[model samples]
Target: MAEKKANPALMKPLTPSPELAAVVGSDPLPRPEVVSKVWDYIKKHDLQNPQNKREIIADEKLQPVFGKDRVTMFEMNKHLSRHLHS
Candidate 1:
């Protein structure tokens, strides 16, 4: 078996849009870090729906990035991609 290396593109730091910064801070961060921070914010704010763990209920700070009141966990990454740039 061969060892696999992480993708440089995925490791590269990306800047977040103003809307995203509100939740994840203004510093540039790798995609995974950004996702982690967003998840932290979501957990901290109790944004995940109790009845449906897969759904996220957006707060005011997250509305601009999410573009709606609610989004599924699977769809969050798609929404976040729009706010990140290399």
Candidate 2:
């Protein structure tokens, strides 16, 4: 059998739950899409702390996923995995 490689697109997309939708919107999207949207929101909102670029300020919708008021960008990916399934 040939070796299998992970397809970036095959990853399941995460849909915003009701609570999340209140902040992000009602759109159901893939994990990558969600992440991109979150990043866009962060950038547009200037949520990143100037002293720490790695840190991301969690808005109301993202607070549940992050489990904290703030998270490092690296931690964002880690936390996002919990909200997704294979």
Question: What is the Cα-based TM-score of model 2?
Answer: 0.70
lDDT of each: 0.97, 0.75
lDDT of 1 by residue, 18-68 (tens): 999999999999999999999999999999999999999999999999999
C-alpha lDDT of candidate 1 relative to the true structure: 0.97
Per-residue lDDT tens digits for candidate 2, residues 1-86, read 99997676755555666555555576667776777877888898888999998888887767887889999998888776666543
Worst 10 residues of 1 by lDDT: 2-11
Highest TM-score model number: 1
Task: Quote each prediction's TM-score.
Answer: 0.94, 0.70
Best by lDDT: 1
